[model samples]
Structures are given as structure tokens and as C-alpha cells.
Target: MKRTTSSKRCNYVLEKLKLHYSGTSYCNCFEPPWLCPEVEECVWKPESNKSKQFTNAVNTWIDLSKKTNNLFIKKQLYEWLDMNHANILAVDRGLYPVERFFPLEKKGIFNTFLGRIIMEILPPCKNTKGKNKILHLLSKACPKRCQIRNLKEIVLQYATEDDQTYLFLLEVMKKSLLGKYNHCKVQLQFEGRHVFYQMFSYQISQKSFFLKWFENGNHQIFLFFCLKEYLCDAVRQVKTVYDYIEKHWKWSIFDKQVVKSMDNCRKILNTISEREYNLLHVSDWISSIESFLLQVSKQHIKLFRTTNAMGYISKLKVNLNKYIISEDLNVDIRQDVSRFLWEITQRTTDKNVFYYALEVLGLEREVVEKVKNEIFCALDYKMLSPNDLFTLKEFCRVIELHKSTYNFVLPKHYYDKQVLSLKKRENKNNQAIGYICFICNDIKFFLTKLSDSSRHSNKLARGSLRVVVDNDISCCHENNLKFVCGKKPERHVKNSKKKWKNDKKALTRKLLKEKQRNFLSKQCIQTPLQEIDLLGHAIQFNNKMIMLCSSCGNVCMLDPESFKYSVNINCKVCHVSPRDICIKCNTETTCNKILVYNQRRTKFHKAPMCNNCTNVYAQKQPVVI
Candidate 1:
């Protein structure tokens, strides 16, 4: 402040410029505080320290490593520095004081991040010696969590058919991830489906690397067979999707894609001859066959051998003795039938919608129930029994035989095939099409062929030549279609005749009602006394003065033909019928009996009582309605 030096003045001017025009002077070309984008960082370069650009980058990385607590950031910094002996020597020779602080094998990065990075930098396919050197470092690495993209890359590019090196490499890769999991133990992706399981899973994916491993792996020569195991898994998946569609006739988009992928994989598999496929699965087949042969040789069957069971065993042996019999065919057929029977058994046990909806056409309810119980009992016994004839696949075969012999009918749903009503037709006429529903009386006029089909009766509108006549009927339903235009059936004609008769009866009733009104009006003026008495009765009698004849102190109408005759006190022959027994006196009486005390109509419930109980009840206090 007393006397400014040149350096202080220059600093003052620079600070003022930075504060006022800082944003204007800045550009994207300026180097970032961390790694420089323009510089090509390499570990092999010895003169990296001598170059100003490289030194600046190294300094920035060192600063970043010191300041950041994040492990991933530190990893990125170390990777930026290109951690290698040559880079280490260059940094040391350059006289960088921070070289000693660099994270090494002892710093926990060795077995984890450093090992993974080293493996990536020196893949076994490219640098086998370097990869081997650091292979020991990966012993502590987490197999399930750690990344191994380089190993997969090695398998894809460098793996050769029957190469010991490739085999050893595959073993190492398999050991890293699939520890203790043998070929049989490795679960298929189809089973145990989970969302997170797909994300981190490095092994057994649809990628080409694993596919190549399967294609190249020699199962016959190696006891640790990789190809045969995963190949079987893929084949099983293909078979499962195919069977559901082929046997059950179920189809879905996802299943279609799965079938396509499996077909592609099968094409790759065909490269290895069918003999190899047999050799791959032969061990399991031989063991099963040996067990069956031993059982037959020892005469294992005793009292359990019924005629049907013996015949089943003979047929099984015949099938097994065929020259073309293979493990895949037998195993697949058995599994398919077992699964189908198991599902059917489960449905029957649960009494699902389909089971409850089952109807027998010509059987009494009792007979149907008994037959159903017997069938279910047999199915339960078959499931529990060890007899060969009752085995799921064998039982299914027996059922098939019986079906051909007896013409056994199955549920309609089981045999029904869903056929599309509106089969899409090509526009050969090159004109717009109109879809019209005569049943619903709906017309989608001048619609393009590409337009979605209109739904009617849960079916799309199909192409058919229909001559529909429009009438006044407003209901958008199929039942009215014949009334509008279509040829009438016998039932429709009968219904029309019945409707005409009903209309005639209704007209006659209307005329009788009008005649009754005119007679009442004329009688009202002619007979004044009757009119006054009737008007008083009509006004006072809210409940039509209807009462049971049994409980009345006076004689009531004996038979009433109509409500008008029953309500008339003068009518002696018309009365409500006495059908109920007396509640108080155990005697026959009318159910609607209401006792009257004095001239006043007492408000009380219709408690059925005999004349003797009514007289006693009249002496006691009357109950209000």
C-alpha cells in the first residue's frame, strides 16, 4: 500500500481481469483438473515422465487420488496412471515425491481392483505369461461379484477345438465363478427364474462366448464335460417350449422367441455329429438300462405281476430293445407324460373350474358322483403304486391303447383347437373392405383390409356373403337377427303363435276392465243407498276387509272365487279357505284368521285360533297390531 512493487501491481491487474471477464475467456479446450482428454495415456512409454503433458496428467491423477475417498475414483486414477513397472520406474526416475504413496499389492486393491484391471490389460489370449503372473492375485476376489469380461473374451477368440490350453482356460474361468458346481449341479437359467439373477450372471448366458464354449467343448474326451451339460440344458428348454405348443397347443410370443434361439443353438450343435450327442448322454442312459435289466434278470416281480402289469413290462422291454432307442427319446417322453399327468392330477385334486364344469350327458347325479369318485380313487392308487403298468408314462400309454379300443371320449376343451374365425385375406381386388355383423346389426363401412377386426360374440367378424335386411328392431344382439331378415326356424314360428295368443288374451282383459268401469258408474247413480254404503266401505276398509272365516264370531264366506266376492260381507259362499291348524287350541282353522272384538275391527296379528279360543281371547285384553 505504501509503495506497490511491479509484481503486486501485475497480480492486482490479473485478479481484476479474472473477476470481471472470467466466463468470457474460458473455453472447453482448456485442460480439466484431472485426466487430460487430448493426451493418449500409455503404460509402456518410458519417456512419460520426461514429457510435460504426461507429467501434468500424472500430477493431476495423484492429486485426485489423495483428495477423493471413493474407491472407484481411486481405481480410475490408478488406471489413468497406467500402473505398471515401466510407469512406476518412470515416475520414480522423474523424482516425483508422491511415488511412494501409490497404492500397491499390499493396499487391498491387489486381489480386487488391481487384479481385475491387470487381467483386462493382459488377456490370456493375448498375453498368457502376464495374465498367469497376476492369476494368483485373483484368489481372494469375489467370484460371484467380480467382473471377468476378459476371460470370456479369451474363450471366444482363442478357444480352439480340443485345445488343452483352452480347456485349462475354461476350467479356470469355470472355477472362478462356478466353484463346486459340476456339470450336473449347474442350474439352468430356465429354472429358478429371478430378476437380479439375470443382471450379475456372467456364466450360462445367451451370448456367443458361452455358445462357442458349448460348441467347442469335447464331452467324450473330458470327464468334466461342459458341452454335454449345457447342451442338454438348451435341448431341454427347446423341448419344453415345443411340447407345450405341440402337445397342449399353447402359444405365446416369448415362447416363439425362445424356440427360435433354441433352433439356432441346435444348428450350432448339429456341427458335432449325432454320435457325439449319444456319447454325451450315454452314461446316464446305461445306468438306467442296467438297473432295468438287473431287475428283470432277478425276477423282481411277484404277486404284483397282474396280467396287465406283465403285458406293460413286456411292451416296455420291446420298446427298450429297439435298435433306435435312445436316452433322449425315452427320458423326454417319460418326463412329458409325467408332467402332464401330474398337472391333471393336481387339477382333479383341487377341483378347478374345468373339473367342476364337467358334465355327463346320460347319467343320474348319484351315478355320476359315484363314477367320478371311482375314477379319482383309481388315479390316486396309480400315483401311489410302484407297479410298472401304473407308472405315469406307462399308464398314459395304456390309456392311449384303451382310447383306440373303446373309443373313449375326452373333455371337449382337451381336444378343441382354437381356429381364428377371421382368417386375414390378401387384398387381391385392391379395394377397401367393409366388415358388417348381421347378428349385431353393425356395419363397419368402407374399412381398409388392414383395419383390426370388429369383435362380435367373442369372435372377429369373418368374410362371408350375407344379405341382411334392416328393420325397426333396435337390439344389438344376435337373437333378433332372424326376426329382422333371416329364414325363421320352427321354434321361432311357435314363439310367434304363442305371442299372438297372449296378445288376444290381454285385449280381452282390457275390454272386461272397461265394461266393469261402465257398469260401476251406471250403478252408482241408479242405486244411491248401495253407492253410499260401498263408498264408506271403500274409504274405511284399507285392507279390503279380508279376514279368515275360522276365528270369526259370526259365520264368514265359505268359498271366495275373487277378491271382490271375498271382501263382500253379504256373500256367504265366498270365504278364504281354512287350511291351517289352530295355534291356541289344536284344531283345524284358516292361516289368515283375525278375531274381531265388539263391532270394531281389532288390530291384531293373524294368530290362527279355534272358535273356543277366540271366545276366551275376547274376554282377555286384546293385543294391538
Candidate 2:
């Protein structure tokens, strides 16, 4: 069984070698059986003197040193050197034996060279385990008293005012540790003191070791008592320093001082709870200042020139408004206070400022009303230009300070009446003389009649005459017809049959004629007039049916005397006198003269007088003529 196991192991080794050598070797077949020995014998046996002599002879012929030029061969040689050194180290440590078959001189040289390479590649002691050992040794060798003294020196060196104060408190606490305050014994009192002292002491010790020391040992006890008495005193000092820098320092020194003061405040506050000491008062002031700053930022215009103290005052007013009632607060001081508030309100972008203002107003109605009234009154008198109107409108919308109750000063009707008067003036400028007509109530009607001189007279003339009525039909006396032809003779039928037939034909023709006559009569009916009926009126005078005025040349079918007459007398030639006149000849006379004018008068007379002319001469001309 052992032989079988040995055989398997030998085969496995040979397989691994073959796989590795495949890329480098020229041969394909395994070595011959006679040359390949048993695995154990090949692994265990050293080369005999004769075999070594033979290997030396073969090596001398092959020039094996030439193959050492390859990088892979050099790497393999170095790996072999490393493996050999590792084996030597393992054996020196009693972990394994050194191989005897390997040449002693070559092994020694490889091991030494590898050892030197490792030592060169290794990191320095500062980064290695050597650093830990050095720290361990120093810790063990240092005395506790010496360490405490060193810690004290270190702490004093780095002690800030707050840190020194804290350190003094810690030392005072240590006095209790020495049993000075044993009467104040309580549960965990020792533990609490130890914890408190250790906490501050360690920090101070670390700072002292690394930073400069301050001389404050003389008053250490006194400082401790002051801190204990007024636990927030250091915080107050920090606040004072912060306020000083904020008010007096520029940006260059502001941040540095702020950081230093804040750190001191933080250290002091962290040492005590709020109940023990309200050190957060400084923080509260800081927060208030921050809030003020935020508000001031919103008021970019007016508040831009504000000093820090002014800004702080403004912020204080804002905060007061946030908390205090205006009536409850001093009213005499409110104006100044509100000015401060407004400055901050305008400067800040904070919505909370407005909200705070609202809250204040809610608490103080009279003050709010006064402020609102003042603002609205100012807005009213402010001669807001067109550009400013829109902004003012928006401001009013946002603030809603007042409701506008009145608009333009003038009454609406007054303006309307003025506009109508202007329109009348414009119309007068464009009006013509004959544009208006009292009779027709139309400008165009009068203007059209005035455009023609003949139509003008016709338009003005009124005719009146005798209209003869025979039975119910009215006709002109001149139109009464005198029969020029006698009535035609009526014919009668002689024979009964011939008479009947002829009568029938005559009746038929008569019926047809009656139908056509009736049709024509229906077509002759005129559309109805509202107030006048022309049902039975007919007249004729001279060549046409006409009427004449009895008293005036104003021709009309109805009597001019029956109705009032007014003529639009434009020209004498075309004028028809409202009393009596010959319209065409521009002569005024009695109606009788116009009706019967003498065409031939005395030829040698001063005037040849027609009937109308003679009457006009009698009335209008001189009797001498």
C-alpha cells in the first residue's frame, strides 16, 4: 500500500512539472522507463560522486550560463533563492530541516543576498512594530508624579481663558479629591468630581503639551470660585468680546475674534447645564443678531447706511414688537421704536418680520391704527407719478393699509356737461345757414329746397281757391266740362230670334268689358294716408288742375287764411310772400291784382301796370309815378 501511494505522489509531481515545462521544453515524450527511477528513490537519493562528475562534464559542454540572460530564468533564479532562504529561516526557527543535497556555498550566498534584499525592502521602524514597542517602553518607564507635573505644564501652556478657568475648577475639584470637602459627601459625588475633573484636565493637559502656557496659577482658586459663583461669567465675557468685534472690528478681524469668543463660550457652556448656568444667553443674543442681520438684508435701500448698533437697536425693536403690546409698552417711545422696527422690517427679507409686526399690531390695536393712518395719509399726498402709481398700487395691495373711498375730484355730471358743450361748439362750426328747418324738423329738406331757386318758391308757395262740389265730388270750376258732342243714338233689335242672339252677344261683350273695368278700378285704389283722404277730389285750372290764393300768392288747395302761413323767403324772385305776392315776378300785391294783371298799361305812363303791378304800385310805389 505504501509503495502504491508513493507511486501516485510521484506521478502527480511529474504531471505538474510537465504542465509547467510544456512552453519551454522541446521534447514531447516522457523519459524512458530505464532512466525514470521509482519516485521515492529519485526524491531521496543524493547524486553519487560519479553522477556529479558526469553532470559537471555535461554542464561544461552546454554553456548553461548563456541561458541565464533570459528574464524568466533570472526571475526563476530569484524565486529559488527566496524559497531557499525561507527554508533556512524556517529550519533556524526549528520549523523544518535544510535540504542536504543543495550546495552549501550557493545556499549560503543566496540566503545572505535574500536576507539583505528583505531588510532593504522592509518599512522603517517608525511605521513598523518598533513604534508600538517604543511607546510601550516609555509608558512603563515614566513615573506617575512626573507625568502629572508634565500634564500640568502642558495644560498651562495651552490654557485659553475659558480653558484656564476650567482647569482651575478641575484643580479645585481635586482639592476635594484630597478630602478638603469631605463634609459634602454624597452618592457618586467622588465619581462625579473625578469624571468632571478628568474631562477638563485631559483636554487641558493635551493642549498644554502642544501649545503655549499662560501664567494664571496665582489666582487659580479665585478663578475657580468665580466660575462656580457665576457659572456663565465666562460666557458673558465671550459675548462681550463678540459684541466688541462685531461693533468695532472690520471683516478682517471679525471672523477670527468671533471664532475665538465662540470657542470660549462653547467650552464654558459645555461644562454646565442650563439649570446650573444659563450660558446660552450669549447664544440667544447671537441668534437675535442673526435675525436682525437677515431682516436688514431685505431693506437694501434705507437701511443700507445703518451702523451695527443702529441695526441692533432696530432688531431689538422688532423683537419687542414680536413680544410686547404697544399700549402696554411706552407709547411716548413708540415712534422711535417703530422707526427702528420699520428700518429693520424694510432691511430684512424675513417674512417673519412682517408676521411679527402683525402679531404686535394684533396685541396693540390703537398703535396699529395710528401707524396705518399715517402711512395711508402719506401715500395720499405723495404726488405719485404714473410709474410710481403701479408700484404704489402693488404696495397698497400687499400692505392693505387703507381702503380708497373717493376718486377724481370733479363730479361725473360736471364733466359730462362740459363734454356736451364742446360738442355743440364743434357742430356750430360746421353748420350752414339753411341747415335747419322749423317746419320739416330736417336740415337736409330745407337745404335741398334752397339748392334750387325755382323749387325754393314752390317749396314756400301755398295755394287756396274755390273747389266746386257737384253732389259729393269736388272739381275745379274751370274743369267743369261742356259737352262738345251730342249723345249717340241707341239701337234696338227687330226680330225676336235675331234680337235674342244679338242681345246675348252684346251681353257677353258687356260682361267681359265690365270685368276688365272692375280690374282697372281695383288697381286705381291708392294706399291709405293717415290723416287725409283723396277719395273724391279733382281739380283743374288753366292747363292743369290748380288752386289760387285769395289773399296771398302762396298757392294751396286749402285756404292760406284758414291756417297760419310762414314763408322761407330766400330771394325776391323766388319768394312767395306770406301775405300776398306774385312769386315769379317778385311783386307784392293783392290777390286780385295777381289774379288779373294788366299786360298793357299806358305806354307813355311812368310804369306799365298789369293788374298785380297796378295794385303793387298803388300799395308799394309812389302815387306820383
Candidate 3:
């Protein structure tokens, strides 16, 4: 979660890629760095569109140069652009650089349109059309610097068919399909001329990942993600000389020289701060602080060097009590103040202190100036981990110590976006007010409905209130907050508690008494109930005649003409002929069959089978199921 300096991270990439050893990690002819991961991940994504265009532009020039002459370049078309250009960028900015590949000696012919295309647009190359089979171009030069030679004999120093740099350039181009930075600054030796690209690739997971990272990841990109872990541990120390002057020397309030010089120093601090900050005054303010510190050093030369001079240690605290700054000074300006304070404390009596500081800062300015000008040179600003309170304290501490190198000038706001997406409200009361639940997006209280609605979002419920800023759902409360929620304001019920009184109440009681009497009368009559008994009947098989048998009343299967009467009647339930027993017991039923039960069989059981027979059959047959 901590961030380190951009320099340290860049160095890590260099070591990790093995490019610091100076031999190529790419070329298979040499041993390479460790292979990259299969997955793609980088501190900064490489898909800068300007970079892709630069890549494509290089290939276009290569194609143009390769074909400029099956014949000599002087006779080919140059003034007339080939209608078949493969570059997506058709503007003059893209074409001008590639056109520079032509010979400068023929500046006279370039005046004519056709002559320009033939001699100036196309590289002045000679096609030997022999075993050499190579394209050669004349290097363009100023008249004062070069010895004259025939156009065909002039040669580019590095451009050659056999140059190994082209192989590296081609492989890098193929990997450009993934992503690249806006300023890759690639150079390749072409067959006819040198090609310079404004951008290049730095994808760390490609086959040539190490080459790209080592070449441009630090110079072109300054992403901080990679340094977060490192920065977490880089402890910040801010040294100040004022503590040494006051506590260690124990200078009294009556010291005339110290008091008078301190007042002049305070005035100078106020003078520089009265005006706005500009980096141009950086050297001027450093000179002033050095002049003042030199005077103090003259008085305490031995003491100053001997003891690192009463250096006091303090941890970063969030609660700074004195100053609250307005937003105008900005975060970046505050960081510059902290940086200036730290450097001022480092004994700037030697001229090299200011000189070396500016030199180092100038180099940093060159690095990040492309994105946001580091003209202010806000180095080590992150060390103090500034907050509003901390920044204001540092500002005062710098002023108090006569330590501002800026005088009043501040550093550049390199990364401040200052996004202003919202309209500012002029008045608190006039500001368009809304009274709504963020979860429900509703202005009114619907207790039951709110209980039913989903708490996560407002759109899912039917009865949920839709809060609209312009709508006035109800009168404002005593506190002027819109808390009222009445569906129909005119007829809305207010909670009321009172005893009920009406003539209808007496009539309602009388109606209830009559209904109770009818209910009691019905209940008494319904108490006496009846029960019915079921018995088996005899069935004659001869004529399909069915009759109830007087003997035991069991259904019997008999021929009607056997004796012109039913005989040998037996009930399946009772299992007795001309007899009755209790069916529940699996015995004969006597007087009357009570709690008559019907026997139902499984589909596997036979029609005439009893419980005992069915069980015996199931065991013997070995049921399929």
C-alpha cells in the first residue's frame, strides 16, 4: 500500500529484465533473461493510440522504401503521392519525416511536383540489380558539412540489408498488437535509411518483454503502482536548522545580531510569499537562504559541524493546530513547501548544495516533463505524506526558519486534474434541496410499502415512493424538513382515539342476539344422528340374479336352477358357509357386521386370495419388483 520513488521501481525493472548487464536479453544468439509469465500484467497499461500509429507509420515507410526503385530513385514518382499508401495517418506530419530519407543534394529538383516525388520523396537509392541484391541510399547532409560525392555513391552510415537491428525491430512490431506507450522512441536500421519511431512497446509478458521494459519503461513511463511496496518502507527525514539555532545554542531574546537578522529574514520570507510562485525564482531564493545561513554558520563553525547541531526528531502528526489554508494554494504547491523545508535544513552554506540540487532536479524535469511539466522540481514531496494540516504547518515552519527557496513561488501542479463536474450553488437555502431516502429514492414514508420493497434499490417495488426534487409531496415540518407524506392531503386521516357512540350500535346488538338463538336451536336438533349397517348379499350365477341371503346374509355364487334357491352361500369376508363371524379378527361375523371393512389387494395378488394366501404366493413366486 506504500509508494516508493519512481527511480527505484525503474531500477528494479532493469535488474529483473537483466538488461543492466548491457548484453541483449532478446537475441537467441545470446542467453536471454528469464521467460515472462503467460498472463498479462503491468503497472501501466500500454495501449497508447499515438504509439500504435507510430508503429504502423514505421512499417509504411519500410514498405515505401523497399519498393521505391526496381529502378533508380531519381526517375521514380515523388511529387505524386502513391494512391496506395497503407498508413492510416494521411497527414503531412507523418509523411514529412519519411520523405527526409531522400538525398539532400537534389534540393533543386524538389521544387517541381513530379521531380519531388521521384527524387525527394523516394530515397535516392540505386538498385544494383546484381548479386548484391541490396538497396542503398545517400545520407542527407548540409552543404557546409559534407564532401561532394555522386548521388548514387553516397551511403547511410547504419542502413544496410545485413544489419541485425532490423530483426529486433520486426519482432518488437509484432508484439505491438497488445499495447504500447505514446513515446516509445524506437530506432531501426532500414535497408535504405534509418527509421526513428516516436513510440514503442513495453509489454512485459511478451517474448521480447525484457527488451521493451529495459529500453523504455523507466524513461517513458513513470507509473507509481510498482513502487507502492517500496515506498511503504522508505522512511522520510526532514531536517531543520532553526531547532539547532534556538535549543542547542540557547540564544537569548536580547541577542542584537540574531534578533535584527531574524527580523530581516522574516521580511524577505513575507516578500517572496506576497506574490504568486514561479519556478524561475528557485535559484534566487536559494541564494537568499544560503546568505542568511552563512552568517549564522560564521558564528558557530565548530558547533555546527561537530554535533549534526541539536537535530530534533518528530513523527508525522495529523493534528496541526495553527493554520488552515484555502484551496487556492493547492496540493502540489504545498508539497513544494515541504521539499524546500527539508533541503533548507541540510546546511546550504556550501555553494554545491544549491548547485547540485538544481542539477539533479533538472534531470528529473526532463523525465516527467512530457506528461506534466516538472518545471517546479518537486522532489521528495511524498516523503512528508502531506495532509492539509501538515502542509500548512510545513508552510509556516519554512517561513519561520527563513527556509523558503521559493520565497513565495510554488512548484508545478503536475498531476492535479482539478475536475469540475458539478455546478456550484450560490446560496445554502436556494440550493435545490431534496428530501429522499437514498436506498428507496422516495420522499414519503410508506411504512408497510417500505417493508415490502427491496432495500438495495428503489425501482423494484410497486408502492415505493419515487423522490423528485421538484415535487412538493406535503407541507414542510416545523423544522422545515419535508417529512409529511399524505396521499390525498385534503382527506388524509390523523390518528384519533375516542369512545364510539351511535344508534346503529343498539341495532347491531339486537341483530347479534337473534342470530345466537337460531344457532343454539339448530345445534340441539342436530345432536341426535343415525348410523347405517352394510351386509353381504347372495348372488345366483345361473341367471345372473342377485338376492340377499336369509342364512347369514353372505353373498354366494350359485346356479339359480340348481334347487330354484340359493345354497352353499359363503362370505369372502367371513370365510364361513351359511355362517357369520367378525371380519376384523379374520373370523366369522355373528349378529351384525360392525365397522365393516373392505379388503383391497395389490396388483400382484390373485382375485380370490386372502391375506395369508397372498403372502405365501409372494414368497414362492419371487416377485419381479
Ranking by lDDT: 1, 2, 3
Q: Supply candidate 1's per-residue lDDT for 8.
A: 46
TM-score of each: 0.18, 0.12, 0.12
Candidate 2 lDDT over 128-221, as tens digits, reads 2322221222221121111222434433433443453333434433332222221211111111222323333344346453233123333222
RMSD of candidates 1 onward, in order: 37.7, 55.8, 43.9
Candidate 3 regions off by >4 Å?
1-180, 186-460, 464-625
Q: Identify the leading candidate in terms of TM-score.
A: 1
Model 3, position 244: C-alpha lDDT score: 36
Indicate the residue-level lDDT of 120 in model 1.
39
Best by lDDT: 1
Worst 10 residues of 2 by lDDT: 526-535
**Whole-model alpha-carbon lDDT for candidate 2:** 0.29
- For model 1, the superposed segments whose C-alpha errors exceed 4 Å read 1-49, 70-625
lDDT of 3 at 622: 36
lDDT on C-alpha atoms for all candidate structures: 0.31, 0.29, 0.27
TM-score of the candidate numbered 2? 0.12
**Residue-by-residue lDDT tens digits, candidate 3, 513-609:** 4343333233222221111111221212212333212232322223212233334322222223223322323432123322212335324421223
